[model samples]
Target: MWSFRTVLTTALVGLQVAALLAVLALTYFASQNVLLAYAEKLTERVARDTTTFTENFLNPADDAAALSQRLAESAVLGTADRAALERYFYEVLRSRADFAGIFYGAADGSFTFVSRDTSVPGAAYRIKTIETAPVRVVELRYVDPEFRPVSRRNDDADPYDPRTRPWYVKAKASPEVVWTEPYIFFSSQRPGITVAKAVRADERLGMRGAVGIDIEINALSAFLSGLEVGERGSAAIVAQSGDVIAHPRPSLVSAGGDQPTQRFAKLTEVDDPALAEAVASLPGGLASLQPGETRLTRFTAGGESWRGAVRRLAASRTPWVVVTTLPESDILGPIHRVRNIALAVLVAVAAATAGIGVLLARAVTKPIKALATQAGRISEGDFDDVPLPPMRIRELDDTRQAMRRATSWLRERRRENLALTGQLREAGRVLERRVEERTRELAAANRELEIANRNSNMLAHELDHRVKNLFAITSSLVALAARTATTPADVATAARGRINALARAHASTKDATDGTLAAIVRSVLEPYAGLEGFRLSMEGEPVTIRGANVTPVGLILYELATNAAKYGALRASGGTLEVAWRRIGDGCAVELIWSELPNEPVGEGMIAEPASAGFGSMVIEAMATRLDATLQRQLTPHGLRVVLTMRGLEEGGPLHGSAQAGGPAAGHSRGDAARRRAWTA
Candidate 1:
């Protein structure tokens, strides 16, 4: 026989066990999510740090030519001019935010440089800046920078010639400056960045020599190292070209030095394909498809399932990308623990709840037990039943009174409960009917939505096709008009101008099928790229405008170009032209300037403002009005300037480093002859 105490104890134990299991399960899931979040955060942080590192690392001057200019300015010094070279090197190093060393590789074998080791006095004139590392100087007659063999000996060795190195060789081969990913310094045993420029005598004479700078990676490492993803989070720095600068694990064990190699033979010894691939494709921002607790894959090291985030560092110049990793287990582990604690608490509460339920059940049964005793007493012929000692519970007292009342009207309540139950069953039946009707209505709505979606897709496709055809038609019309002109020169000029305009509009509209208004203006006016004739400036950053608006802008620019080509300063020799547009407060402004040669007389016959409003003038006025712009035309002895200020297309406000009227575009690619012809004729 089970006593009450034994039963209660057994139930409590069972409840506790159930609660503990629930807590453990919840803990496991919560911990996993937390770890995943942490991993993603870590990756993002690494990416951001790397991007910032690269941006500040490059330290580009407001002038792009500054780097090359500095090299040229210093190269003029004599070979034996160590003091001048050192001064220039120190100045160059100081100009950068992350330079660890600066060196100039002249055509001659002699090399001059400054190192990060400030402890070594500037006056300490050793044959070479590096004193300790074994110098394996390889004279690759074939290699520009002969591969310097890694040596351990400190004895007197040949000067480590950098010309034989890849960085020096590549820079020498190209006219443009080159930046290399971070790598361990062969001499200093520290990670650093290298930027090289092919020194030239002037703009015309190219690649006279090469000057280089190396920026240390210690500060970047510090930034990435401090980021915490979760419990066990890690971060790494990678170059834009996917070269791993910093990582948590050592996939490639450099034999003597820390140079990472992709030799499959070495990778086979380790037998980690994932790690090998990761090493081979490192510094890349990508992930694998294999599913696991870890959300991101492949890039992270082996055995550690983790969530990953990545960001590109210092956007201005360097292409370093930072990757941060969070071990899923570490970040989520605490949350799981907290969940378990909560589950345990909930379980204890559940057990208490169950115990209370049992007590309430017992209280309800007490009255029945009392009734049984009373019935027995009545059977024994004791008519006077002492009213059960005043009931403790109100429900029990009500029950007792009900029982006495039932002695008089017991049959009526039984019928009432039965009748109410019958009514409840009928109400349920009606509710079921209503639900069915609602379900039918929902199905109809779904069908309607499907039809609407189909129609919308069809409409979109038709719109795209029509827009393309409209552009083609417009282009054809312009070509025909150019060809139909009566005079041969006029025909050729018109055909050329109209064709160019159409082509420009088409180029801008490549993304839109037909060019947007903004695209049309940019492409048509682009040929007058760097005109000294007039000041051309843009106020608004380029924007995508509607096709309807694009046509008007295109027509207006065509008229302006035609007038300038025929009679404006653009027709005069040595004249300059500038066309620019930009968004201002709640509007946009487009200005075109044609500055004539000094003392050049204005052509009254061809250049006097059109006596009667022609299509060109009308078109200009209409377009300006459409854009809600204020139009101005000013004629100066030096040039004619046209200004149009249109509302609703303004670029925010003013910006730094903005192009001024007559300034060249951000990336103008034409040569001198093209620029000169466009401005003068």
Candidate 2:
């Protein structure tokens, strides 16, 4: 089956990936900016702390000069005990580790200074005293930590003059403590700067001497190296003129030389490219940089950008710049690490999302496929007998419900269709039967219509002939009776009686409420019951005659009895006749027999046929034909025997003869008093 799983899964995965990428991208850049700003702030703080450390080191020197000035004004320095003064100097030497010397330079070009000496294999203090008497002269010496003279040297008369030194010069020029220009210390031959103050015992005794202390380059370099900057960070102290007086990288402070090598280099003239770039980016050559404010500088070095922070030390008399620089790459390393971690998390999340998409797509599509198959089954008229499992997906569940409803509806329709089919079959059967009955009725009606048409054509002539035959039959009977009458009145009475019998016979055939074979026979024999010479016997199983067939049966019986009454049975002193009718043949047909018994002597001249065989014979023949009956005659010693057989008599049957067979000669039906004289055989 075709499915949407692939498309849906792909869409879901695509949406998840796009969302993750968007989040990762946004985080990478956003965090990059935040982390870089935080690192910048950190680097600035480190630079500030380093500068503060340098400034604090110089503050002590200025405090010492203030103490000496107060003591000189009180005459304590000039009158102090020698041992006490030496103790004071020894205490000063041990006060700070970075102090190279504490000395006094006289206005007359004489100088004296104390120092800690370690070159003599034992801890000691050294002192330098200068004399300008008889040409400039100098002496170098060493001292114990207690200010006891440990070693001394009369070096030489030298061109060096303490009075001409910047410290003495600056001390005499200013009332406040002064900082000298950075230079190599005369005793240690190390680069240094001095903080000096002028001192006098009394105002009248003019300037006596300059008290000074020196900060050597080695001490400053140690302080700079101890700076806890970034992994690739470097620190330096630059003088106001952009001179690097001290730095962690000594090359950054000095040019290479052996002859009293220059201990400092201009900030812009530093040998290291990265350091030079850092120096070049200083704010106003570091002199104009404000204290407590970080001056951030970015410059390219070694094909990479570096950030340098410079702050002018507010406490330095020489006005120095404390500078720290770090590579931009290291500063952003943590940001990149965070970014990579975020990317990995995004990848993992996307993978999980894809997996979930596939699972959900299967969950949805499996049910959909089942529903589709069920729908196809329903289309093919198989509405039930298929299993439908439940689903978890919302849309799939809704669809399953709809499918169930559809299948139920189809089942209902199928049941209704089955019922309707049964009803239609029943209706068809009823319609078919009705159609057959109508066909039979139409056939019967067609037969009746044909009979009516024939009756229409023969009605007028048949009526005229029937009327004439009635008159003729009456006249014949009257003529035959007159020959046997004694008088004219007697002849008339006999004719009337005979005519009344014919009239009653016709009426009997007409008013037949009882139309059975035996009933009709009894009705016809009513007139002959009281005859003195006649005996009649009617015997047979009773049978009913159809209405159309009744008239013919009654008329034929009357004719036969008429002949017996005229010349055969009723003429004798003891006459006998028998009439019988019964169901015969297939139980669906019947027969009636008629014959006479001998009352007088048998003779060869007995009536061979009816005396005229005229009206009676023709009527009898017509009735027999209409009834579809058989007739037989034979001569016997007692009388003539006549038999008649009819078929299809048990039920109303098809007519075979005449359109008019209702009455005989218009008066001879319903018939004679004694209809049949039978042999009873």
Candidate 3:
């Protein structure tokens, strides 16, 4: 049979299990929200950091090209000093290892350069210089890493004109430094681009020259190759038009590699079946996208689902997207793992809780079952040989004791009824005696249960009384906090914060658990903290404070804090604040220092106190009196300095606080009943 104990326990435990499941579900969704936010922040940071690196790498080349342009406009190139020009190119090329060459072309079809020695493998000591004029000739030279020439010679080469070169034409058309299309250098046979700026010695003289630097594109490829995304995920930089500029995987951008026969490929033209399929899944062929736009798509690749994202590079001059792709397993594996772990925990807890409920129900029902047997014996009038067991339960034991007394009384009456029945001739007297004894036993059990019931009611009433008192006090504090306010917004701001502070004390211990003095200060300063870049520096050991002590402490700090925000460091952009505290005198007392320094200094006359006492001033002084600790205020040239020495609460827990915290429009409230009375007056 299902006993009352089993039903009640099952009902309670079932409700608890349902609640647990609800909480777990909420927790999972909340974690997903947090992790999604984290992932977005991570991607944004990666893009920004890469942008910084690219800018840093490229800015110097532009600066060097501009400097050479300025040098070319000077007399160094005006007189056509072949010797001076050759030396200048050599110095510039030697400074950067990746610089293929530095060149300067004149309007009169003359070109000169200092380029690497590509004629021999691993040759670093010598470089080639080619010059053209009335005669086209090439000079071979040796130089150190610092560009001091070691040897020089003139060489035979094909005729080349500076005016016919693409860079010279591009420079004349451009007012600022310009980058040319990527192409192979004649000397090195390696792909590169030139950064050039045009220079004129004198505009009226009609003498113009272009100074340029060629940077190898292979360096960019090497950099991009090192970047990675998630597991099995790779990043690639692709031009908006259609070209794949850089990628870690060679197959994605080229038919083969850095070879003469291999052609550079685009995302839309990869020969690899997997990559081709991935690109085909995109709605358009990568050209429809704009800068900073990101999109995700899935495609079947290598017999697995693949996820990829394409985001335009915000810093690239030409439209370029950074694409990251990986198999779905690589990204969703961890999420799946977390889900399985949560399910396991839920199952384990539910089983453990149900097991506990079953055991508890059995223990409770065992006693009640024994009591039921004793009640049956009394009802059947079987007083001679009745089975009655002792119970460990207090109430059940009391019932058993009552039944035993009833049995003893009926036995004595049965002996008297035997003697009287012989004279009166009625055997029903003994049965009547047994009925009377059973009724008395039932009445005694009822009285004992009533006493237990009264005790339970008294405890519940005490608990309710305490709860009501807390609410009444909170209501009073809220009302008092808004007493000085004239607007609804102001009243809301003031009343809400003080009430929240009281509520926080009830919700969490706040005695000592990592957040103590520092936390309390943050709660009071939160409103002012909303100002952009506004800072509140707090430093201290955890100060444990509790109970009524919070009232004076919260109120006192709020008063001083409101004043500081109104007229001190928080008012100016350049201003700063410092708050520090330390435990003192056997850790029973703590000394806290609050100091604010403004953007600029004020005169000594500004140190004077206020002309009239405001309500805030009255509250501050009133709470300060109750602190039973030393308080000092100093006015400096920069701002205000307030030092407080407060004794520890008589009984304190430890922690930070909980409050949604209104803005600075609302003020703090009177804490103690004594202080509230004075404020009202």
Off by over 4 Å in 3: 1-25, 76-79, 121-132, 138-159, 183-191, 204-207, 225-228, 249-263, 268-318, 324-332, 344-681
Judge candidate 1 against the unseen true structure and give its global Cα lDDT, from 0 to 1. Answer: 0.52
What TM-score would every model get versus the actual structure?
0.36, 0.45, 0.42
lDDT of 1 by residue, 233-298 (tens): 666655444455654444432223334432112333433343344434434323321111122343
Spell out the clash pairs found in candidate 3. 138-155, 494-666, 511-653, 511-654, 512-653, 512-654, 513-654, 513-655
Off by over 4 Å in 2: 1-18, 79-87, 118-123, 132-138, 201-205, 249-252, 268-274, 341-681
Highest lDDT, which number?
2
Residue lDDT tens for model 3, 1-681: 566676866776678778877887787677766654554444444444554455566677789898888877776554277778777777777778878778777776666677776354434445544555566676677665566656666667555667777778888887788877555555555546688888876656654778888886566657666776556655556565556666665435554455655445755676444445545676886676666667666678878876666677554444556655666565556776887887788778777777777877886687687767766776676675466676667877788788778888887888898898796655577778999999999999999999999889755754564365355545544555455678989778876776676555433322323334445666655444433344566655545565556666766665555445445665445556777776567757777787877665655433233212654455556566786877788886667888888775434532222211122211333121110110000
Evaluate all candidate structures by whole-model CA lDDT and list the values in order.
0.52, 0.69, 0.62
Least accurate 10 contiguous residues by lDDT in model 1: 139-148
Q: What's the C-alpha lDDT at position 668 in model 3?
A: 31
